[model samples]
Target: MDMLSCDLDRTNEIPLYEQLYLYIKREIIEGRLHYQTKLPSKRKLADFLEISQNTVEAAYEQLTSEGYLEVLPRKGYFVMASEDLEYVGKLDVPIKTDNVKNESFRYHFHPSIIDTAGFPFQQWRKYAKNVMDERNSDLLLLGEPQGEFELRTEIADYLYHARGVKCSPEQIVLGAGIEILLQQLVLLWDAKTKYGVEDPGYHLIPRIMKTYGRDLYPLQVDNSGVKVSEIARAGIDVVYVTPSRHFPYGTILSVNRRNKLLNWAAEADGRYIIEDDYDSEYRYSGKSIPSLQSMDQKGKVIYMGSFSKSLMPSIRISYMVLPHQLMERFRSELSFNNSSVSRMDQHILAQFMRHGDFGKHLNRMRKIYRRKLEKITEMLKHYADKIQVIGENSGLHIVLVVQNGLDETLLVKKAETANIRVYPLSQYTFEKKYEGPPQIILGFAGIPEEDLDDAITSLMKSWGI
Candidate 1:
């Protein structure tokens, strides 16, 4: 317990008290300090270190606040057995060192069509001011774990009219994002729930399902969307699908496939379907497809929607329309966990929807995206002989199917060397072998129309077209 013997270096940039705090925390994490070990009196340590008693006291206070130590009346301080010191210490460290060396640090791409500089900050500020001016004390506190009532109701109304989704505000369970809601669904249906994920799908869905220890059935999808017959034949307990606009491929699920899938879910008693309606609002081609939930006569589909793609990713507000029978169960389980969307953002979003600004914003973005898509299409036409650009009829990204057995990995690396970001279709496929031609999934939504020509030129050169 002699502090001087421990070599306390005061010359270091860190303060004396903070240094002491970190030293003790590291000792606990390294297992050098065992549980229930009594420490020498603070006064004694202060005397040994030639430091003030207050400094030792301050360090102890910080340790106690962080749950590293506990104080018993007349018994002094003891190391806390409840604290996860080792896990906490290792949290900030990198998870995988090998991957860090091979891959670029930048993975998430910013769409070209999205004008971040043009966000309606002034209008948003006005709305925020109005909310604060008419503050409700109840609203200031956590209103509901599901969501603020007004936002859910507004969303219900919006979906019913716009997307043809049938549901009441009560059916809408709001959360931070689709990932959180998906995890909740997996936990809800924990017993032998086999999730049928689209092969070559959004990579996150399969990863998340596996993280939760759920069995996944990789369902193959083609130009017509997920093979509904195969899913039914496999007898999956739960099916996760993107019907509006399929991820990475941009193929809309055919109405025939959609109907069959619904019928299959209905036939399999106690089975459910999750329809991820992501990026459907910004369709550049024909009318926006009706949601899978809208076609459900059996009420078995759980529709998942997010504001991230349409609005901003950081907004983190997503919702699901649950079946009537499962509503009570969802509420009962979620009531204990501190998982709820922010009330302030919810209020702002609800007001945006109520005032019809949400619709206006969508219209504005759609026009911008359409114009950008046109310019990109014109540029790609020059290299049509080497690459076929598909899926430009809708969505923010287009698929460039390589012809003549081109090496897609080399194209990706060459594009990276030229400071252009492009994703290979192979990255999304779960199976080792795929029947489709090699393609590159190039996103145009995150780039500017002015830069489209130059970017496309660089990409074409990289492909040696």
Candidate 2:
């Protein structure tokens, strides 16, 4: 057939039969040739392509054996594997290749990156299949305005048990991510509200607030996290705090400051605190830290959590627990906005939690990350004199307070020269400059346990530490 357009490269090392087989296989898998389409006869194809008849016959035989085609009596080979072809097509996803112009590193310490090798893909696939069954047709339609009650119920239960966060499923709102939820919150709150954000904190929160023209005060951070007294001085209406383990620096908020921050929000009617409990799941030493939401006596804290770090980031499932007042306000004002997350994903995650897979996965990842952190500390013991480690008590990353005549910029550049990428703590700041000691952040979660030696060793060589 004219559609079987293939140029035979006789000079190529691959035999003509194998090449023809691969070409026909790709065409069938990619839907260029549909199910039940008849192929040219072996002799006819050989003549058209100026190849031997045996070559065409061998190709057709291979395709038939692989279930890509079927032959009927007196009829030619026809495409027979539609369902199998779909599965094969899905596996042929396009992989992105790196740009030759850009620099690629052997070791990268990206703080937000997580190891997906531990993901329960088999279990997730099972739940996904269950959710996609024809019986669950309701998932195809629009779900509840605030995510599916099933998923919210699971999230509420998990938070109550794991993080001591007290909230009903009704108070939880689900979205595609923290960014989407933050955007919705900016729309709900007053435009004039001055938000207080940590100076050396997760930069995205302040950036998101600024995008909506919300006034922001950069609250300087110390070893004990953000101070509540700073909020009073700035006249901030709201503040975003990471109480469990501060982002980048990993400073845990002191109990007294937590109480004072709660009091600060309670003192004013409109004042509230948004606790972003990002990456608190893996505490290497002691028990997992309880959330700031657990200490709120007044309805002033909006507790937000994401699966981006604890689970797979690509899932894009994030939820926020609203106080009764804000929950009521969201219902009355923001009810028109539908849930940003997919109903199918919600149902699947609910099933995953229902089967206790999520809890098990968290426990497994904790042990895995704990081993990696321990390996890192063990390997870096030799360089202890040159570098001081901080924020390794919890979370996936640790900050190395380094010296030996190297500034933050020089440290990063030196690591780059050694084919390793390390982050500087100053990158987290925007308005106010980071006045702390020169610190380089190394995220250990994505790094494998076996390579911890080489990675840390290479990094040390890079910095001459």
Candidate 3:
């Protein structure tokens, strides 16, 4: 009983029961209490803490309900075998608290967030139960290496109808996330392949290539996506791009450059293009441009997309559409690898797509994000004299190019002083510093719609614009 010490604050507004429960939970999480460790009886704890037995009983009941503690008939409450908690406690390095500090900001303009409030949890739960209810023997077995065939079919059908991508189910490869799929793609290619990435492209693409020890060149981007001419100049074999809507700048590849890039891939023996169509689903104004994979007549474009942005990041589901030329190689060489995603999750998502819940969710989110973007654009009107907005017509984030001549570092530091967080556009640039006007990327997807105006106003006030 002396092993567990809880200092109760009778003066604090929080209920004594809740404080005691939290204390025990923390002990369990931090590994101060080992698995199956006996806890003091309610009466014993009440006597030790100088509290009523009812308070101790209530705390134990809550902990028991949450699976942190278990009671065996006449025996005392014991901590469950929580492997997850033990692993977290054993980590040698400090857990990153960058995400934890997100709450400290009065206003957050984070770019890579989605509204989880609207997530179809109940509907997903229904499908999840259905998958288990059927108890199909097929589900019990390890799924195909590429992924469940039905899921690939559903993804293929959805891509064709939504993004104008034409592909057979056999062409799609599912992984836990795009990074895993990219690693597999890298393994499929020769080690000597020189990859070309857009100057201010998605940061992870180049980082992934570097992880595989491949040589990479950063091609500069203009009004129309990546510079296609630079591919020939740099003598690169592969180019990775976000052609549908470029990151930071949000420039869609013009028809001219799209054709030129395709030609470059076709002309060279080993040249290929990797089209990352992340966040292309949220185009607000004009019609969403068809994917570069849809436009490629030659078997050169390798299309990759993920549900993390559109659905939820925690789902860890992403897929890639391989060109027929590489599909053959992937089958013969790498088909033996096990799928990184859970088979149950794959089937549940397939059900979600087939039943049209996914499409409905996307439509609902598109509207919500569109309204958020509109509100952000309207509120930032107060700063129109000091800031020029770009890339507002599409995607989760909009670029605010400051006209006041403040450098990127000072602008971000100023925002932080006001408890506002703004992301620098230059951070996305690789190798070279962004030579354009000082800009910040404000992502509206994560921030609540009601908070958008307040966040923008905070930024304006912080900047003194």
Give the 10-residue window scoring lowest on summed lDDT in candidate 3.
Answer: 93-102
Q: Which candidate comes out best when scored by TM-score?
A: 3
Q: lDDT per model, in order?
A: 0.77, 0.84, 0.84
Q: Which residue pairs does candidate 2 place in steric collision?
A: none
Tell me which of candidates 1 and 3 scores higher on lDDT. 3
Tens-digit lDDT track for model 1 on 1-465?
A: 333244565433345676677777778777777788877689898888766677788878888888888889999888876455444645232232211121221222333234555456766777777676555545667577678889999999999988999999988988898888888887788668788988878777777877887788889888999988888778688988999888867789998898888888888677898899968897876778899998999889999998876777678899999988778888787667554787888888888888888888788888888998899888888877888887888778888888745677776666655645566787677774775567888777767677778778877776677
Predicted candidate 2 versus true structure: per-residue lDDT over 1-465, tens digit per residue: 444788865533355677788888888877789888999988778788877778888889988987899999898889975775434643333333321112235777878778879999999999999999999998889989999999999999999999999999999999999989988888888889889988778767766876888898888878889887889998999899888988877888899999999989999889999999967898877777789999998999999999988888788999999999888889999999999999999999999999899999999998899888888987877888888898877788998988777888888878866757778887777664666568888988877788889999999987887
Cα lDDT of model 3 by residue, 76-165, tens digit: 899987773334333233233223132335666777777878898999999998888556667777888899998999999999998999
What is the TM-score of each predicted model, taking all chains together?
0.76, 0.77, 0.79
Candidate 1 is scored at a TM of 0.76
Model 3: residues with Cα > 4 Å off, grouped in runs: 1-104, 137-140
List residue ranges in candidate 1 displaced over 4 A: 1-93, 96-113, 404-406
Candidate 2 ranges with C-alpha deviation above 4 Å: 1-104
Model 3: how far residue 316 lies from native, Å: 1.0
